[model samples]
Target: MPLYLQLEARLRHMIDSGQLRRGDVIPAERELASMTGVSRVTVRKAMGKLVQDGLVIQKTGAGTFVSGRFSQPLSELSGFSQDMRARGFTPGSHWLDRQHAMAGPDEAMALGVAPGTRITRLKRIRTADDEPMAIETAIVTARDLPDPSMVQDSLYAAFRARGLVAVRALQRLRAGLATQQEAQWLHLKPHAAILRIERRAFLADGRVLDVTYSTYRGDMYDFVVELTASSTTLS
Candidate 1:
């Protein structure tokens, strides 16, 4: 095996075994080279591969550190709170705004409601283990969710309590750069990569339960999709 690949594998093992942890700074290239009796070039190459694989992150002058990236599977329709709990992270939210308001054109269209229809708007910064991860804005018709204040952390939980559970949802994702406000909320530099997600959740009766727009930090979050071989056969 190549020296660099060997080093990379060793580092990966350390991380997996918890010898290295998220936000833990890695040894400098020179120190790693000295400790492993490898060339600095090989150490750098291994670290670079780790960065590309999202196992570590490099700062301009602060050195490299283990990353705390979370991956969510697109095949499962679950809420952020549930996802984080499954990963052993405590999910939290800081309310930015929560009130009843008239649905705008886009919200109305997404919710299949008339423009100016009354709706409950819930805007908050979503957190995992007390670290901000995304900015979420959710809208639901007043007829469905009469009180937005009832939602303390997980909107899905509130909906379930009200017998408005979402059975399925249509979600769309796109890549973008974070705006200044979004960066402030997510504690990232302006223009940092972000993933924008828009989802319309439906009840078992086919009513739109909620329309949620979320912006997640690209560096801290990953969306995975599973694929299988197509059933179609070539002629």
Candidate 2:
């Protein structure tokens, strides 16, 4: 086996065994080379493979650290804050923009409202354990949420407080490259892979409650869906 592959395997084992943990800084290339008696070039190669595999991340001047990747179950209907808390991570948000405005073409269609209908728009950078995870923009009719300021952290929580909780939602996910602005907000390099999710949430009475658009860091987030075999057998 190549020296680089061996080193990569060793690092993977350490991470899997919890000898290394999320946000734990990896040893410098020179130090790793010295410790393993491998060439610095081989150490670099191994580190590069780990980064490509999303097992580690390199901060320009801060060295590489174990990646804090999270998996979200697609079957559950929950807000980011709820999800993060469930995973034992502190969830927070940095508000980018919050205002009341007329619904645009897309937002109007998604919320099943007229284009000129008043709406409250809430945009923020969502974080897990203080690490930027996603950018979210949520829109709702002003009648439901009169003010964006009412939402301090989780939009769903605010909705529930107002007795407007969404009972069901339809979500669509697609792969895309992050825009420069999105990259900056998510602390990722320009053109990095991102997952765009559009969700339309409905109230119990069948009225659309909210239309939310989110861009999640692809390297740090995974969406899991459970599959079940068909009940009927194919002859």
Candidate 3:
């Protein structure tokens, strides 16, 4: 979590615990600066995030007051498509490329296969509401998923519907500069910041089903996570 977010959580915990009761006027900027022992700018940043999350409301003549929350859980993780559907939003996509071919060096190693092995590959530009958001390229061992043409956009749902069990998965995200092709598809300028997501899909019995690399527009979305202190520690 960002330092500003940590400060936000600290204040939010106070609000949730009734330390700062509802309808109670919060401290002023200078007072919060002294109380929280942080710079006034940091306090403002935290308060702004809380307002954006709808946990607080500010009044010009008065002061900040606690607000109602939507009560999101800490244990929810779903794909973008499923998340939008749950919110009653229509989700759709455009097919970019779908083909089957042999795995190269990196794909072969990640899929736990020998070099020059056959692999099924599917590529698509994922979008919602006509705005292209992400470009997904998935690579799977042909021995596991030979029919790459049948994949639409949701590879996880496809795997489950085909009676394949997806036990667990790992995803890595980092900042990336968009390439020419990626920028064109995502409707962003070249070298724009994007979030690169690389995931490895695994079956129940340790069989690697696929490895997917996706680039998401940084501006339109923010990946939210609920993490505990122990999450940063080794098991």
Model 1 per-residue lDDT tens digits across residues 56-104: 9999989999997665778889998887776666799999999999989
**RMSD of model 3 against the true structure:** 8.9
Error of 1 at 233 (Å): 3.6
Q: How big is the RMSD of model 1?
A: 5.1
What RMSD does each model have against the real structure?
5.1, 7.0, 8.9
lDDT of 3: 0.74
Write one digit per residue (lDDT tens) for candidate 3, span 80-166.
Answer: 576544434446777776777877898899899998898888788876545576888888877667687666656767666778766
Better structure of 1 and 3 per TM-score? 1
My TM-score estimates for the predictions, one after another, are 0.77, 0.74, 0.66
What ordering of candidates by TM-score runs from best to worst?
A: 1, 2, 3
TM-score of 2: 0.74
Q: What lDDT score goes with residue 152 in model 3? A: 62
